[model samples]
Target: MTKRAGSAGRPTKPLLKAPVRIGSVDARAVVGELRQLHEDAEDPDVERMPADDELFGALLYVEKHAHALRRQTPEVQRAAALRRVQLWEYVREQVDVHQMHAVDDARQAGAQWIELAPVLAVNAPSAAYNKAKRLKAVELTDETPQARPLRRTPEAVLRAERRIASERAAERQAQEVAQLRHELLVPVVERLLEQRESFESDEDIDYWWEEIEAVLPHCQTPLQMVSLRRYLDAVLRALAKIEKRTARPVALSEEALLALAAARKVRQLDASR
Candidate 1:
């Protein structure tokens, strides 16, 4: 009899394959999730919720993911470089389209390089200004065959544009003031030059007098109106000289004479409002 019955050997189970790890991950999302986990783990109240092991597990998971990302950094950079090149190609295409259109047409269609900069996402709004300058240089070179290449940073281009615009606005304002002065004073000056006996009528002189009066009320400084009145006095004196030289009788109305006298009496023009 033998020996005691041998214990049945435990049934063998088939070996299972390890789970496959992902080769790629979204770095931004992973970092954000890991940051949240770290915050939770460090919270004072977390001890009452998840145990120490759970907190440590979250940290370990993050560390492992970080290591994986570090290993894949070269590949990620390569992909990023490829994407940047593609985006620049798209920008060049847009530049070409802009160049093909007439300047006014491009402006009206919102296809100008400055306008296209935003859609291209080259950088911050203020930092994307160089595309227009660069495109313009390219066009000039193509046309002239030997034009020098232009290379300017976005910031430099922006500053230059602002300076040019301000200068243009100032020039336009000066031209407008010159035109206004011509309209208001030139005809009277011409009449004086021609040695006319008198103004066309009292109403003609009144029209100019009224214009000066209207401008005086809106003058920012007393000196501005004073200067205008001085100029008016000069014109009246010129007229008076012509009349005296021709030995003509006094033709100016009493009101015109009084106005001229008041202008001549102004000794100093004040800058005070």
Candidate 2:
């Protein structure tokens, strides 16, 4: 049976924290990493914590939590618990004791907590951060910590990258062909629009009709019969029209008769001379 994880009816119930899964490595390896960080820290008396207070704060935090944090894997549950303890101590050491601007590193650790708490822990982010800080000081709430700034993402750039990668060679070819058509088709359309050239060039339709008819005398193919008969019928119709015009005399106008009479008088005058 496929077991569903979430409760069907009680949707509003928050998700619980879960353990982080370390790859190949186990819980002891992370303890070793934390130990190395703790062992290397310089004493506050010998050297003042660096002016870049956030770094010193984070380093100190890792040292303070190293013991409890050792057993914790980088996995969500353990890491969340470790961070909560560390942050709680840091905040308590602040408002309760010194209350002045002493060890004021809330923004650094708290902001980091806001960002990472969810991945580390598996519950609501605001609730987790609050719970983590409140364990030491009783005053923290869901709204107690200042909000973490939103990080920007290059979604458009990533989408473009994915689109280019996912496209097939045929799709690329189609885009190229479309772009080429736009470039080539526009000029052709403009030329036609201006009537710069005939729709069909004279060379395109120039029929070597005499050559076609010459083949008719020896034409023996079935396909040639239709062409031959069509051509001969056209020729016969043309000849019939020519003979009809030749057989009929055109009626002469009065102006033509007058011109003929004048030419006769001129011929008579030449004879007299």
Candidate 3:
């Protein structure tokens, strides 16, 4: 049975001497500083405490040396514990956000709620869906450590659903834009590659050719899709400069011309918006 949602109380505050805002400082720097202070208290002469470059290793060292830390003064121990608690809280909040995103992705990939039930440790599909919704609601809440958490009310859940849907729609549109741009660029790049040997000896074409070559691998993957259009424009500009002195005009395939038109229309639409 689903338990009734309770009213959210004042959010838990870390046992910090001065309330340090979470995320305002880099985690490595904060943890490293705390580790230094604690280490100094434990053994001031230890030469091998984790340096700035070895923050992760230092964190692991502290984990392994927890027992030794117990002998340190109460003040030192309390400060360490406070930072740990705050960091863990932030980590848990991010975990919930990731979990919700994962569930959304699974659903998009055609995984039924019944299939997710087992993975979510829930007995039924509805429970799994509700749990995901709750997590989404939590993500929509203020991230400040002391902010009161959003209650799992019907209204809050509805808001979460709407926000998630809007975001997913935006993501789909961006992906579509990328795919369209890729289609526009591939043919142009193929033409460039065909003419590469001819351009190799031309000192004037060398700079732009090298630039295009540097970004070539990235164009083949969606990893840099957002910048792909810019790269294509640069390549086109370079091609224009190269075309000026060549006896033959650079020509594009009929399909490539159509794609270029479509891509420009998309760009115009985006600019108008």
Q: What is the TM-score of each candidate against the true structure?
A: 0.29, 0.17, 0.43
Instruction: Mark the 10 consecutive residues where model 1 has the least summed lDDT.
Output: 13-22
* Cα deviation of 14, candidate 1, in Å: 69
Sort order, lDDT high to low: 3, 1, 2
Report the lDDT tens digits of candidate 3 across residue range 1-273: 875677554353331123232543366776676667656666543356566455455555665565666777787777777766666665666667789899999999999999999999999998888888777665454334754355554355676567668889999998887677567655656555455554323454465457566666656577655455555565455555656757544434555444445444554554464
lDDT of 2 at 45: 34
- Candidate 2 lDDT over residue span 1-273, tens digit each: 876876375742332222121213222334444444334432223133222234335446554554543443456335545744554455444433342222135444445545545643536666544444333232221111542211112332244335445666668886675445334433332232233122121231123235343544555454554454344334334433544667631114444334323333433443354
Q: How good is model 2 by TM-score?
A: 0.17
Predicted structure with the largest TM-score when compared to the true one: 3
- For residues 16-45, what per-residue lDDT tens digits would candidate 1 score against the true structure? 222222323343444344444445445333
Superposition error at 170 for model 3 (Å) = 13
Question: Among these predicted structures, which one has the highest lDDT?
Answer: 3
Instruction: Give the clashing pairs for model 1.
Output: none
Which pairs of residues have clashing backbones in candidate 2? 20-75, 20-76
The TM-score obtained by model 3 is 0.43
Candidate 1, residue 38: CA error in Å?
Answer: 79
